[model samples]
Structure formats: structure tokens, C-alpha cells
Target chain A: SAVISQKPSRDICQRGTSLTIQCQVDSQVTMMFWYRQQPGQSLTLIATANQGSEATYESGFVIDKFPISRPNLTFSTLTVSNLSPEDSSIYLCSVGRRGLQETQYFGPGTRLLVL
Target chain B: SQQGEEDPQALSIQEGENATMNCSYKTSINNLQWYRQNSGRGLVHLILIRSNEREKHSGRLRVTLDTSKKSSSLLITASRAADTASYFCATEWKSSGDKLTFGTGTRLAVRP
Candidate 1:
């Protein structure tokens, strides 16, 4: 099992500003994923952060809006740019441990409220 | 698009009663997992059932998978008030790189 931690557990930011959320894993992982959950909604996959490569974003999400950086196997960052009230959601980081049959462990989450 | 969708959007039951939630997916998957979230906190993985497996049990939790129907069910027996929360089923499709697609989730309320 891998232990995951996220920074800025909760933050309230002004509209048009940017906030970067960090994810740290206790062990090296092959892949880390970013997700978003709006109020009263399910989790949406934002992107897959791969070490030493550009992140692969899902449909309806882009790097320009949610830029992701994975400098190493155990660390990654996701930046929500040009925030708006609609962007007020909980952002979560998850990691998949190797040989675990693809069970992903998640961070506590970063609650962002764009005012 | 979301790969999984859970049924009975909300369920309220008395403590010690059983709670059952169902999830249906649109595509084939390598594995399906169940997770629990307490309010606004992160999700805690409860169990994972591979495509080849039909049923699995963990403590008071029982998960069953029907690959042909592309559906799964999670049953929690003798529930407590603390078990009240949102439960989600995630599918790890073969196409997507190990990333999970979560369902809307079922809100279960276990009243004492």
C-alpha cells in the first residue's frame, strides 16, 4: 500500500487566479492521476501524470486549464488556472501501486472554492 | 464520459440492516473496485474484484461481479451509523491507463 498526501487541504481563491495542488506518495508509483468532483457529483478524471513525460488529459480537460507536472515517480502537481466559481470543486490525487491489481489510493483532497 | 453508474441514488436504512448498492458500466474492464468516502474527505478503497472473479468478501463487505452483465453489487451487512456516507464503484477499463472512472455514487444513511 502507498501513502498519499496532498497540500492545501482546503483553500479559497479569488476568481481569475491560479492555485497549484501538490501530491506526494510514500513509494514510487508508475502512474499518478488527478481528479475533480464538483458539489454533489461524481469524480471526474482530469489527467494522468506520468513521470518524465507530458500528462495525458481526458476529454473536456486540457493542460492549459489544468496543467500537470510529474517531475519524479513520487511527486506531482496540478494547477487550476483562471479559476471561476464553476471551478469550485474538490481536487484529488491518486496513485496506483504496482502488482496491486490496479487499486488506486487517493489523497485527502484539496478543497478549492473560487470566489 | 463516466464509465460507471450506480443505482438507488440514495438509500436510508436502520442500523443493523443490510445495504446494497449496484453499479453498471458501459465498457469492459480489467477490474472493478468499491470505495467509501466520509463527507468531503478522500475515498477509501474497500475491495477490488477482477474480471475473472465472481465474488469477494472482506469483513462485513461482500462484492459480486457479473462480467456478462457488466454490473457489480456491494452488500454491507449489519451496518452502523458510521457506515453512512457515499459509496462509489470505479471501473478500470482496458483502454484507459490504470486510471479509474467513478460513478455518481450512492448516498447511504444508516440510522440508529
Candidate 2:
């Protein structure tokens, strides 16, 4: 199991602003993922943050709006840009250990409220 | 079995009683994991049941997987107030890369 932590436990921001949420892992991992969860809703995968290449985003998400950077194996960041009221949601970072079939450990999540 | 679906979206039970939540998926999976979230917060990994494994246990929690039926269930025995949270079931298929498809989640309220 891996321990993951996210920065800015919760934040309130104004529209059009950008917020960068960082994720740090205790162990090096191969696959990192970003997720968004609206209030009372299930989580939706945003993108896959590979160590050395561009992030692979899901069909409904885009990089311009949600850019990701995974400089190394243990850390990654997700930035929600040009935020809108609809963008207000809990952003989470999860990691999958090497060879671990689908066991993912999630960070506490950064709760963003766009006003 | 349909992908990412759970039954009895909400459950309320008194402390010391047992709570059970069921999840059903559409495809063949390598493993299925259970997670718990407190008050809409981040999820805590509870347990995992592989496709070849029929059942697993962790403390007061019990998980069962039925690949033939493509479904799984999570059971929490002797519940406490702290157990009053949302529980979700996530699946990872044999061919899908590291992506976990999460279910709708069950809101369990353990009243004292």
C-alpha cells in the first residue's frame, strides 16, 4: 500500500483563477491519476500522469483546462485552469504501485469551491 | 451485471448491527477493491478481492466476489458510528491498464 498526500486540503477560489494541487507519495509509483468528484457524485478520472510524457486525458477532460505534470515517480500536480462555478469539485490524486493489478491509494483530496 | 453500479444507495443501521453493500460490474476483472469515504472526503482503501478469490476478510469487514455473476459485496459487521460513511466498489479489469472504474457508492449511516 502507498500513502499519498495532497496540498491545500480545501480552498475557495474566484472564477477565472487557477489552482494547482500537488500530490506526494511515500513510494515511487509508475501510474498516477487525477480525479474529479462533484458533491454527492462518484469520481471521474481526469487523466493519467506518466513520468516522462504528456498526460493522457479522458474523453471529456482537456489539458488546457486541467494540466498535469509528473516530473518524477513520486510526485505529480494537477492544475485546474480558468476555473468556473462548474469546476468547483474535489480533486484527488491516486497512485498505483508497480505490478499492483488495480490497487490504488488515494490522497485526501483538495476541495475547491469556485465562487 | 452493468458497469459501475451499486444497490440500495443509502442504508441506515444501528450501531452493532451488520451493514452490507452490493456492487455489480459488466466485464471480467482482475480484482475488485472496496473503499470508504467519510463525509464526502477522500477514500480509504478497505479491501480487495481478486477474480480467482471467492472471499476475503479484514477485521470487521468481509468482501466477496462472484466472477460468474460479475458482482461483489462488502459487509461491515458490528458497525460503529465512525463507520457511518460512504462506501464504494472499484473494479480493475484484466486488460484495462491501471484505471479503476468506481461504482456509485452506498451511503451507510450508523446511528447510535
The most accurate candidate by lDDT is 1
CAPRI class of candidate 1:
medium
Best by the DockQ measure: 1
* Backbone clash count, each prediction separately: 0, 0
Name every residue pair that clashes in candidate 2. Answer: none
Q: Please give the DockQ score of every candidate, comma-separated.
A: 0.72, 0.70
Model 2 chain B poorest 10 in a row by lDDT: B1-10
Give residue A77's lDDT in candidate 1 (0 to 100): 98
Output the number of the TM-score-best candidate: 1
TM-score of chain B of 1: 0.97
After superposing candidate 2 on the true structure, give the runs of residues whose Cα lies further than 4 Å from its correct spot: B1-3
